[model samples]
Target: MNTAHSLAPSQVSNKARVLLPGARLGLLGGGQLGRMTALAARAMGYRIWTLDPQPDCPCAQVADHQLQASFADDAAARELARACDVVAYEFENVDLRLAQTIEQHGYLPQGSHLLAVTQQRLREKHAVAAAGVPVTAFRAVRTRRDLAAALAELGLPCVLKTTRGGYDGKGQWLLRSTADAARVPDAVFHGDAAVEPAGESDTALEAPLVAEAFVPFVAEVSVVVARTAQGDVVSFPPAENVHQDGILRFSIVPARLPQEVLRRAQKAAERVAVALDAVGLLAVEMFVTADGRVWFNELAPRPHNSGHYTQDACSTSQFEQFVRALCGLRLASPRLLSPVVMANILGEHLPAVMRHLPAWPGDAKLHLYGKAEAKPGRKMGHVNVLAPRLEEALELLRTLQVWGPLDLPAPRLSS
Candidate 1:
């Protein structure tokens, strides 16, 4: 028996299940991703329920029922699985053991193993490399001695990241020289911090670390792929990503790269989805070097920020595609309907964004996640600008003063 085949839904004694409209879909997270997914599921005639510590989480605003509990609470996780026909998760940092417990209660199409592999930096890199994808040089750092050895091997300007529980530029420290190493704790490098209640422990949480050699890349791009239990797969057009201080700030769809390069990225993403037997949306991020080499950067096994452009550019958005895949419906076309650029609205931009909201061009669409408070670096929402040509859309995005500036200009779009 092939292990890969066994991992899929077919191996289960129970036959493949299709969740029709009006079924209660359970989500493990209630952030913006869950909110958008819930909205899509509701439009397709499905009732949505979610488990989130915050009763008024973004998803709670749209879901039929909200189980107010921590993600690590096994009892709440089990209750959520029991209440819904099938279970899915928006975020990847969910407790691995809790997900396994939920699996015992009901359907979790994406599976717990995929979650386990993605939640840790070291595991994700190893998994991607095993799939025959190229990745940057990296080493697991578990002690001060290990960090010293890794730095000696990988060199200065390396990035030390927690093995688990970090996102949006958090839980990362850049060591540019020997002086920077002093700031990182010896215990942090060793993953010796005790796990605390509510998943909070130390100033820099105790978790294994991975020190990676930073690559000088010309562009960052991502491919979003949707896969189903039946092995059907479809990929959205690649998106060129721009980041500020490690946080994604903008994404340009139909990334201005050679057709051959785009094809390579797409194919690699499809291979990754198959290797993981991923059952929903999987976003594979890659780096394109100045020499035209593409290297795997990371993975998000759910609707990604880069794919947010699909909401206005494609016939089927990534969020809706996630819903379709979760419900066992046939995957829809991810073909681009128009050239577009999407800008993430950080908390700092909220005031300006609201002031200029009514003045935005008719082709520009703004989506605001209903977060109660706006803090610096928090993803409040986003704006998608559409046009007949990629350059036109990018030009419109560049002109949006509300976003401050397009700091890293796209070489192809820059005049």
Candidate 2:
């Protein structure tokens, strides 16, 4: 592990500087992102402390210490601040008042303001639009009258989402006709069949909502940008993503698109990071049209699932870039080491995936979260398949077919 530089003028009794290695880093959320980030920080000779309600969460399993408490626990929040030199967030669902307490300590570089913007659909879209990035047509809906008006304005085949919370396709409704828009403002209910998916699990059922024009986009892509407080930014390779039921199914590197589309997507993502004046890592999700124009979709200010392939296929992994960016170290080169296809392993599919693991290819890298039990639709782990040719990687992935979207299917072993 490279120290690079040491803490300034070490005190005889006590010394701590978040800028250098050997300092304790407190992670706010303890899912797989925290788990991976902690692993990276530990490899760099830094201590890890995770704060999450789950005592045995994936991140806590690897952390040096764990603060087992809800995000609403102020005492635990302060304890984390006092114990660690710096704090970084692994997720965006931190409580509002608790964020105020943590921000008072000055360790949170990407403050509550960023959270406030991303937590709400309307504000996020406005910020992206203000950054001169193109976004789909949208309108705010408050009452039943407002819902009717928005549907009339944006038309059917639009999406109605809660302004706050709701992630990974939950807490949203796709209205294709007057019937879908019938009950609104007072309450919006959905059948299991009517639910649209999102990237996270924040279903803010009671919060206000926003309506957006449904885009007939050909592909969805994301770029993970790492920026320091000094404005230095490095955007990772744009990944073509596939989502079903509102959850990411897989992320394909060297996206099967024209070179011009890839270049513009990366540039557009960087522009949004600059526009938001973001520090740390920001994953920018965008919709790329057939004509090569890029449209902003959403932002996740943390290590994103879309960039998971970087761990096995990039010169510098997103986790390492995360630590470097937060600690003010020089950014690493975002070069692709090989073509990769990262596929998510959901809970229901874990058994089949494990059964075939013994036959996996030499270059296939598997990462499983330390989750106790597997539930339907829960993200358990992911595998990254790397090959000399991108097509070869895709073919290799196809052979392991427990996971599937429209193009990919379940694989069966030869008898």
Candidate 3:
């Protein structure tokens, strides 16, 4: 399936009534994404429940009911389903069988089928290609021999990735040459490392990986599209993404792309949403080639790391749209209200950087996740700067990241 444009206006508002306001919304996983989603649902008069192993999870702090249990605990799953009207997940690593147990009693928008396909790189890629979207050529690797064979097929400078449970550049390796290709198995798992995750239970050590040809792209962009059970669909403008150390550093609205290429990316995202009958948000990541062709890179079947900018930049954030669509509410008008840029605060130490934030204009929006501890590469919060010109917003953001003082320029805002 290719990312094509076949969105019907009616499909834009097809949520089920079971997830309406006043209903207890059950969310699986409790990270910053869940915290944001819970915050939106609570603001709209919805009661929220979540099951997370961490009792002090950020989402748990705001939810109406928080169950401290593992995703694999059948008792926890049953309790979660019985206590809520609809069930949802904030992340993609959810177990399909466990999710199915919840769906037997409640609702999982996009449902088990979509989750099953999306939780694996191989399946997600195949599904995207089946929908008519162009993707980098990939082959599955089940054994060390399979890795060697795939290398021969896809060639060097390719990506070797776990079919399931890989995200944010984790569970992936780059095979630069034949020597590197020969070392795939050890890089994937060796002796004690292979058995290290036995306690996690949810992570399978034996799952196969997929080797894919790496595309040389000019920029990375993502499209957040929403669909309802009634079949209506709408996609927001593509957001340009930049990564530092494999973690997303910032997301800018109104990606600086050729108009035609932007249209292609948006259309491809719409196609995937419609084909999968995906309800709620689907973030389609794409690679824009030098020749201007937008190739489908990956898909996140939930609110994405990139769309976090929508919270302060657009008329409707992805969180609100997700809640509205899941509750069968009329889709809100998604209009761009400003030219904005979002910079992620990765470590807890960044709060020290806040001393310099005062230099930024008052119009800039900063949001901090209520995380108790700050660790390296941990997403702590984000600062969003808005201006008529994207460059001005970016400059103000750059100032926030500088280590020491300098003669920073004044920020200009348009009337």
For all candidates, the clash counts are 0, 12, 15
Best-performing candidate as measured by TM-score: 1
Point out where model 1 deviates above 4 Å.
1-15, 190-207, 411-415
What is the C-alpha local distance difference test score of each model? 0.84, 0.79, 0.76
Question: Positional deviation of 210 in candidate 1, in angstroms?
Answer: 0.2
TM-scores, all models, native as reference? 0.92, 0.88, 0.88
Residue 112 of model 2: what lDDT?
Answer: 67
lDDT of model 2 at position 321 = 93
Ranking by lDDT: 1, 2, 3
State the TM-score for model 2. 0.88
lDDT per residue, candidate 3, 1-415, as tens digits? 1132335656543435545578888889888888899999998999999999987898998898899998777788888988988788888776666687887876766677667767767667878988999999888776687777888888778988877677778777888988877765565533221212222233332346778998877778899997766766778888888776567877877787766778889898988888777887899999887788888888887888888888887888889988887777766656778888877777754766566667767757877778878887888887778888987777766666532332322212121
Worst 10 residues of 1 by lDDT: 194-203
lDDT tens digits by residue: candidate 2, 138-189: 8877666777888899887998887766778877778899787885434542
Q: Report residue 244 deviation for candidate 2 (angstroms).
A: 0.8
Give the residue spans of candidate 2 off by over 4 A.
1-18, 183-207, 404-415
